[model samples]
Target chain A: MSRLSKKERQKLLKQVIKDNPFLTDKELADKFEVSIQTIRLDRLELGIPEVRERTKTVAQNAYARLRSVNEGEVIGELTKLKLDNYAESYLTTTREMALQKTPIIRGHHIFAQANSLAVAVIDAEKVVTGSAEIKFTRPVMVGDVIKARAEVKEIKGKKYFVEIKIYKDSDLVFYGDFTMFKLENGGV
Target chain B: MSRLSKKERQKLLKQVIKDNPFLTDKELADKFEVSIQTIRLDRLELGIPEVRERTKTVAQNAYARLRSVNEGEVIGELTKLKLDNYAESYLTTTREMALQKTPIIRGHHIFAQANSLAVAVIDAEKVVTGSAEIKFTRPVMVGDVIKARAEVKEIKGKKYFVEIKIYKDSDLVFYGDFTMFKLENGGV
Candidate 1:
């Protein structure tokens, strides 16, 4: 093996931590054949967070709960109706949209698919978005046959947590948890 | 005065409340000479939330307090030297990176700005993101001297809430509150 310079060693250490986040510091130190302090310095230099801290924070905001939909038969038809709600909608591969082979569609069309379903989840006549946090895990394109589903997760003081999931066939594609507020009748 | 149809009235009502979120239903009803219920229906049909609910949610998230900084001069100098501790680095728009001018810099650059600034805020030996929820607010352009500032807002267990604010020419542009976890020293 070629002798690694300090800069090269540090870069390697950073890459190791980034690629394998679950690896413990002691394990990393042992693998690198370096002192623990050296590993620590490498981490500090590279800005890799501690395991416990990173895991806890990620768990706090992450609302990913995957479940099978045996109701695909019903969901499929609902998906078509849900899509028709948009001003103009279609299904195509990611390549189609990326290549601009068809009329360009706005990103909001996808957003509205998830949004309209979330809006429908509120049993109230008037629902407003109190807080919305979404994570786009993958790129969505036409011909994906994406199915959108929203479920009520939390309810407190006229506020509700509605989890919306978008799936391409059976694979999970996009997920978001929207916190909505039910507006009072005739009240602002 | 021209007589407006119900559809016209509803459209006007939506425009009014959307532009000025501070307006109340009663005030709108009074201005439009319509019943309170009419105004509420208009809001419900248009998917507009009440101001109170939005204000309350904003307060809970502590974003309302930061709103005061929107029009003021925010500091951009580094008080600590941890630049070498980051895995990535780059400049981003004060607003959303997606809104930046196309065929210019890559989105990775904007992601790096938030990531590096977040690394700097940890004040730890190493920091990495367990999860993050980023929302683009506005567009950014080149030659914009962006000052990205990140602060450890909340610390629960090992996860830290790193709030990042990007400023361009003294204007608050991009704001991201990322949840980062602290990793063990020397851990990969």
Candidate 2:
């Protein structure tokens, strides 16, 4: 690939970091075919924090928005929630959540992010999984950022039917149809 | 509940610890309506390690049995795995897996455990979840030990049907039926 102009590279760098905040400066340099100093200067010029700082800020913002579910319960950081309606979460696959043999993120972590978002979107005291139909369309690797969205499709009495879809950079990686059971007021 | 004889209490203590290695001596004392010292003595007499030691042993044993899948990908420690046949795993709910408002374990943790075990049981270079039907029969609290079992019920071409069940003690807590698709050899 031809070398990108400084302006074009800076713009692309911002987009890349937004898409995957876990990419280190070295990786960015390799990907952009630029020096590490160039990437750092570009990041500073764009007012983008370092990768670790970016991740922490994103996680804190997501944690602050948690409403129906506990901060700890959600597999990923929750980015949005509208009770009994819609929810969105963000998960960055880490080394700890990847396979040792390969750096690929495990399927279950994706499922957990989807399933938990489905539960978190419910307006109830307690929610449990009744059933789920899930599909993984692609493999996700470590350092990938997954954005999962859950929409409550229907509610029949105490049962909620939710549709969850996960994406990595505009590509669908996973989706699930989840049926959740909501407990009555204050019941276990 | 009535008070038990000394021998009965000791036996029960050992069994309880086996089921939930996270329970502290004080918690056991509270449950048994005895002093902490008494519980410690009982543990000593039964040759049972302390809670932390018990947890470490279980985790180590589970980690030792892992194959084909990354150790970090599985939510619980894998105790047994027979590729394309059967698998078993153990999880001890920690404070991080519990709800802030309530100490009950998050539903997704249970789902992750079952889902990962289902993926691990497949005999393939790569396995992806195609769909799943899951039910949470009961709430699991913090400090609880969850044991999950997955059995491959059927295999057809590239698709494998798996049944996963999770239990807290003898009580069934969750169950799922998963359909997984195996990728062709060396396919991404």
Candidate 3:
């Protein structure tokens, strides 16, 4: 990072953020030993969007694929989906999610977010959950936002093992491991 | 029901609804071989609320337990909860849960409601999900109301296996088998 030429640095920057789109410009600058402005210029010159825009594009692309292929479901506000790889979504507990007249959100809702994110990450037109193991570490309340990220840990024939974790800000509130069945091509 | 006296019929009605709180008045009327009005009268005489109200009380009781016991979560509006036995909740898809700018509800929100109900049904000072296997059968639209019911199928030491299902009216939309961990008394 320190000794690369301008073109090489820009290429590496692209790869780094492409791999992990949540990195801030300031963080990139620190890693690259450059000013934030320099990082921004590199992003612009390379025709790359900011971290937020990058995620929006990934999520939007996944939606487009779902639309084109015909069937799939994604719950929560999908923020990013790289099918067959990983996906993430955001959900904020609303009053409707709380126990009637109470502010604490139901635990299943947290699992739902994680489980659905796991489902969304599958690279198939149709996927169904086969089973799950999950844990809730903390409680979520109405108006609190959670980001659920799911990654495909392994795929065996038609069976996909997905791992999901949810955070309220940086606080981990939920976790899930899902076994999903891809029902494409007669389940292969 | 025809052979029983009025008091006996009423007693059975109360117990039936207590065991399964979602039975509609019409269903009860059919089961009792009595008119809807007669079922209503029996409900009122027995001091048992209407099906909707009955669920509300059960759900509210669970919420109260959560508050006093200091942990546990319910994501969807809990409709009913019988700790160490069963619980159910309701959720409606909102625009926030859809893919960005799309009307399709994300898959995870469906799981969230069911998973939360599973968490709310445990009789414990603290509980966490251990794992789950889930399947999505149909797409959920914005404004669609889903009923998620979780039943404690078995318990082994501190681990509980809960089965959850989500229905849109009578249409089964999702299913999950969950492994949950109840963390009380050092996990017993």
Candidate 4:
């Protein structure tokens, strides 16, 4: 593809980073066909930190507002949560989560991310999974960053119905419907 | 409880070890109110290996028979697997899998063991989770050993229905019903 003009590239840079915050400066420069200095200037002008800083900021904000689960209990970094309404989280497949013989990511890691998000979206003192219907559309590999979004579809009595969708750069990798039970008495 | 006779204790020892192979010899001795040497002698008579050896034996056997997933893809050490039929696995909750503040085991780790076993029991080249219904009966803690069993309930075309139950020391901790999809063409 042809190189983008400076003004157009700067406009696209913000969108690209927003979509995938893990991209390194070198990668951004290559994608935009711009010099590293120019890419750095664009990022500075946009008030966007480096990839690592951006990741840390997102993690801290999400973890600070966590309610349903402890800070470290979540399988992924929660980015948004609306308590019995909707939630969003992000996870990067790591070497430990991949098959030793094949570089493919294990299915459980993907499932865990969605399941935890489902539980986190519930507005209750205690929540547990009652049931789930899930699908994996594609096999994810190590180093892939997954963005998972969960929405509360219904609430009846002590049960919360949640729908979760996971993506790797707009490709649907996994989806699930989870029924979570809330503990009103807060015993277990 | 009152102490049992030697013969009764020995019989109970074997049963306990069979149900929870992760129990150490010292733990067994404590439970039986016997010396550690007596426990060792009983294990020898019963033809049972030590805890570590038993765990390795179970893992090796399960990994050898694995077909759908790679050796490391399964969440826990599989003890049994019959393709399109039934499977069993074991997992020990660790510090990393617990809530940082409360030390309660995270729900996803329990779900992962069941979900992965559900996928591993499928007789397919590429299997993916379609949906699941699950329930967590009680909160698990670090150091708890969970044994999960998965049974294939039905298979139609490329869809598999599986039922999973998880136990911690003979107490049901979690249960799930899973629907998995198999890719017939095996592209991704």
Candidate 3 regions with alpha-carbon error over 4 angstroms: A1-11, A22-35, A67-73, A76-114, A117-127, A133-188, B1-11, B30-35, B67-73, B76-114, B121-127, B130-188
lDDT of 1 by residue, B58-148 (tens): 3333322221111111122232222222211124234332212132222234445664456444544544454455543443455444556
For model 4, residues A79-161, the per-residue Cα lDDT tens digits are: 77777788888897899886454566777788889888887777766676776767777888899888999999988888888
Candidate 2 Cα errors over 4 Å, as ranges: A1-65, A70-73, A184-188, B1-65, B70-73, B124-126, B182-188
| Per-candidate interface DockQ score | 0.02, 0.41, 0.30, 0.45
Error of 1 at A82 (Å): 13
Candidate 1 chain A minimal-lDDT segment of 10 residues: A65-74
Q: What CAPRI class is candidate 3?
A: acceptable
Across A61-155, the per-residue lDDT of candidate 1 in tens digits comes to: 22121111111211122322221121111123343222132232223334445654554445554554444565555545555545576777767
Worst 10 residues of 3 chain B by lDDT: B65-74
The residue-by-residue lDDT of candidate 2 on B64-100, one tens digit each, is 5555565667777776677778888888889887667
Q: Which tens-of-lDDT digit does each residue in A35-81 have in candidate 3?
A: 99999999999988987787677657657644212323444667676
Which regions of candidate 1 are displaced past 4 Å? A1-109, A186-188, B1-188
TM-score of 4: 0.81
Residue-wise C-alpha lDDT for candidate 2, range A72-116, written one tens digit per residue: 778777766667788877887898877676666777778778878
CA lDDT, candidate 3, residue B148:
86
How many clashes (backbone atoms < 3 Å, residues ≥3 apart in a chain or on different chains) does model 3 have?
30
Write the residue-wise lDDT of candidate 4 on B1-188 in tens digits. 36998788878888888877778999888877888999999889888999999988877887787777888778888888778888899897899886554566777789788888987898776776776767778778899888999998988888889999999877899988888877664422
